[model samples]
Target: MIDSVQRDSSLLVHFTLKLADGSTAESTRNNGKPALFCLGDGSLSEGLENQLIGLKVGDKHAFALESEDAFGGISPDLIQYFSRRDFMQAGEPEVGAIMLFSGMDGNEMPGVIREISGDSITVDFNHPLAGQTIHFDVEVLEINPVLEAANADPVG
Candidate 1:
């Protein structure tokens, strides 16, 4: 038995992600090779994977995801106000610039520049897709069954 993107591990695939505004956010079709990733990896959102399950090679699909199931609904806490001086100290912060900053736990997090006031710069650390629904267009170009995967695995 084999699973497509729904499987724990997918060898290769081609897909496109479109925002609610009908704009492409990401796509593997642009490249000649299909995108490949190990399942359960943080690379894909669970909600996005749910739509890909049970699909087979050459399957093309489109699905809409709610904010909660996608990057998760917008969290007020994720919004932070930083001092303009602090932002300048780090470097000249510009509107629409994405920044990398340390989280409270010291993990690096990415935040986008939203607004710049006199002394405060608002940064949104939430996933860009957070708080919004997204559409995914997928085409399964190939399926490497488990038997073939086992044969390729060194341990198997």
Candidate 2:
């Protein structure tokens, strides 16, 4: 029998991600290798993963996902500002440049430069895919569901 998600505890899939305009954004087929990932580990988005459940090996699917359901809708609060002095400390800000900086709590955050003016630079911290819908075309190349009945270690 083809192993379904509930019957198989985990899965390893080779995927091809595409944009709404039919452009290929990423794919495992190009590297001549497959990408392995555990299900329900947040490696795949919830909405997308939810759609994958119950599918067996060798199943091909194409679907459209909304921005909110995909990478998530853009957030207004993600837009931030940095003083000219701060910009100088980091480096010069160039339009369309992605820069990594420490947040107030010292956590690293990536910000994209959108504009620069006399005393401040505008940065957008939202994910590049934040506001755009994505089209996903996935194939279930393999399935490795966990075997609860197996005699091996539980951690594996």
Candidate 3:
């Protein structure tokens, strides 16, 4: 018998994400292979993860999440303007081009070019999907429950 998904269960699933307008944002179904990940691993938001706790193999589910529960609302602090000179070695900036910038913590963050003035370029660091509701369609392909240690005692 197949086990149901639990908080720490590892799962393989096929999923598709759509916008409120019914436009597909992303999907694994197109590739014909299920994606695998462990629960609570941060691959999905906590709100979305909580919804997967009781699914079994072969089960299909669909739901929608508001902006706050998904990528979240846009943050004004993430929008900033940089001097054009900083991108000199990279060539001229074009609007809508995504560029990676190193953070103070040494991790890279992607920023999309929004506008280019004479000496300033506006970059928006907010996620492209921010402020939009998301629709999710999911099919659970496999589930592996957390195994108990061999030395552990079972309680009746």
Candidate 4:
């Protein structure tokens, strides 16, 4: 192992995300491919990335993050009602099923069907892991320190 991970360094790590109940929610180790990420990149949330700082190669650690530190708690305003007719073309809307709906920006946004009331269907746009505590288990496999601007090639 070299030294501790520092800002701007690229890291290769295996991580597992689990809920309080010990049920695995996601894992990169299972796929046999370690995740590669550069510090300071937006790919990871600040809260989650902060937990990785100072870890060195071959280090294993777990962090517990509250709902606020992880994904924010569910927001009631994110739940919306849409007429049944609007979703007939896509397919049947079933409770607990996640579907992609066109957002105001014309991009697709995922929402889970929470309830059905006659002609009205309620969809919740909050993240599936919102409002919960998460156990983040990480193993740092490799760390590639970033070269200074003066020593690095802008393009190769």
Predicted model with the maximum lDDT: 4
Q: Ten residues in a row with the worst lDDT in model 3?
A: 144-153
Let me know the TM-score candidate 4 reaches against the reference structure. Answer: 0.85
**Which candidate comes out best when scored by TM-score?**
4
Residue 58 in candidate 2, Cα distance off native in Å: 1.5
Candidate 1 differs from the real structure by a C-alpha RMSD in angstroms, to one decimal, of: 3.4
| Tens digits of per-residue lDDT for model 1, 115-155 | 99888899998888888887877777666535444676566
Task: Please give the lDDT score at residue 106 for candidate 3.
Answer: 100
Model 2, 1-156: lDDT tens digits are 447764324666677777778898788889867666566676667777777888878888888889887888889899998788987667777989999988899999998998999888999999887788788777776787444576587575
Ranking by lDDT: 4, 3, 2, 1
lDDT scores in order: 0.78, 0.78, 0.87, 0.88
Mind giving the per-residue lDDT tens digits that candidate 4 earns over 1-156?
448887767898999999999999989978888888788977766788788889998999999899878887899999999999999898888999999989999999999999999999999999999999999999998898343554756685
Show pairs that collide, candidate 1.
none
Global lDDT for candidate 2? 0.78
TM-score of each: 0.80, 0.79, 0.84, 0.85
Off by over 4 Å in 2: 7-9, 145-156
lDDT of 3 by residue, 33-96 (tens): 7777688777777778877889888999999888888888999999999999999898998999
**Candidate 1 segments exceeding 4 Å error:** 1-11, 41-43, 144-156
Residue pairs in collision within model 2: 8-145, 9-145, 9-146, 10-145
Candidate 2 TM-score to native: 0.79
lDDT of 3 at 33: 71
Clashing pairs in 3: none
